[model samples]
Target: MAIDVKPALSPHLVVDDAAAAIDFYVKAFGGVEIGRVPRPDGKLIHAAVEINGAIVMLNDDFPEMTDGKSTTPPALGGTPVTIHLTVTDVDDKFQQAVDAGATVVMPLDDQFWGDRYGMVRDPFGHQWSLGQPVREVSYEEIQQAMSQA
Candidate 1:
C-alpha cells in the first residue's frame, strides 16, 4: 500500500545561508514562513515556507552531515532547473522580485505562446520564470507566430 502525501512534491533548496534565503523569499514573493527547525549549532536543519499557497522546503547546506550532500546553486556553478511561476500580474511580480535583490535575467515580454513572461535570478542563485497567461493560443497559432518570426 502507498502512503498518502499531503503535498506530493515540494522544491527543496539548499543554500549557503538559509536564513537570508528565507527572508528573500518572503520579501520577493510574499512568502510566509510556516516553520523552521534549527540544529544545535544554530544552523537551519529544515524550514518550510508558503508561497502562493504552496510549500517550499529549504535548509542550510551541511555537507558534513550524512543527509546533506546538497550544495548551493553557486557552488554548483549554476542550476539547470528553473522554477516556473504564475501570478495574476506577471509584471508586478517580476518587479517585486527584482526590488528584493533579484537580478533580471530576461526582460518581461509578451511571448508568442500567449504569456507575459520574464526570468530573474534571486540573490540565493535560484532562477525563477515568472509568467501570466494573457490569452489562449492554439498550437496552430503558435506555429504561425514562429513561422512569421
Candidate 2:
C-alpha cells in the first residue's frame, strides 16, 4: 500500500557487516541514509540509502533464509559484478574511497572512451568503478576506438 520508494531498478546488496558498510557508503560515496529496519537480534533487516540520487538497498546477511546462500563476495571467491559510480571529480572521489579503506583495483587513467576512470575493491570485497566524463565522443569515434582495442 506504501509507494515511498520510486526506483524501479535499485540494487539490493547483502553485506556481512551492514552497519559498517552503510557507514562506509556514507563516508566514501556521499550516500544519504533515508531509512533502516532492524531485527530483534540487533541486525539490520533492511536499510535504504540514496547514492547520487539513486536508491541502493542493503541489509546484513541472514543465514537462516535460503539455506545459507547469502554469502559475501569473499566467501564466494570474489564477485563477478562491479558497481560503477559517475561523479563530478573522479580524482577526489577515488581518493575518498581509498582513504575509507578501498584497495585500488585499477589505477586512475584517462581512457579512449573520454572518461577519467579507475577501479577499487572495497573493504567488504565489493569492486567499485569510479568515473567522470571528460569529453564527448561521437558514435563513429567510439566504434573506431573499440576496433583498435
User: Which sections of candidate 2 miss by over 4 Å?
Assistant: 1-7
Local distance difference test, each candidate: 0.90, 0.89
Candidate 1 to truth, TM: 0.90
Relative to the unseen true structure, what is the C-alpha lDDT of residue 124 in candidate 2, on a scale of 0 to 100?
82
Instruction: State candidate 2's TM-score.
Output: 0.90
Write candidate 1's Cα lDDT for 1-149 as tens digits: 99887845789988888888899999999999998999888799999999877889999988877454658888889999788888998888899999999999999999999999999999888898999999999999999999999
Q: In model 2, what is the error at residue 66, expressed in angstroms?
A: 1.9
Number of the top candidate by lDDT? 1
Q: List model 2 lDDT by residue over 1-149, tens digit each.
A: 98696537887888888888889999888889988899888789899889888888989888778586867787788999898999999999999999988899999999888999999998888899999999998889999999988
Clash pairs detected, candidate 2? none
Q: All candidates: CA RMSD in angstroms?
A: 2.6, 1.8
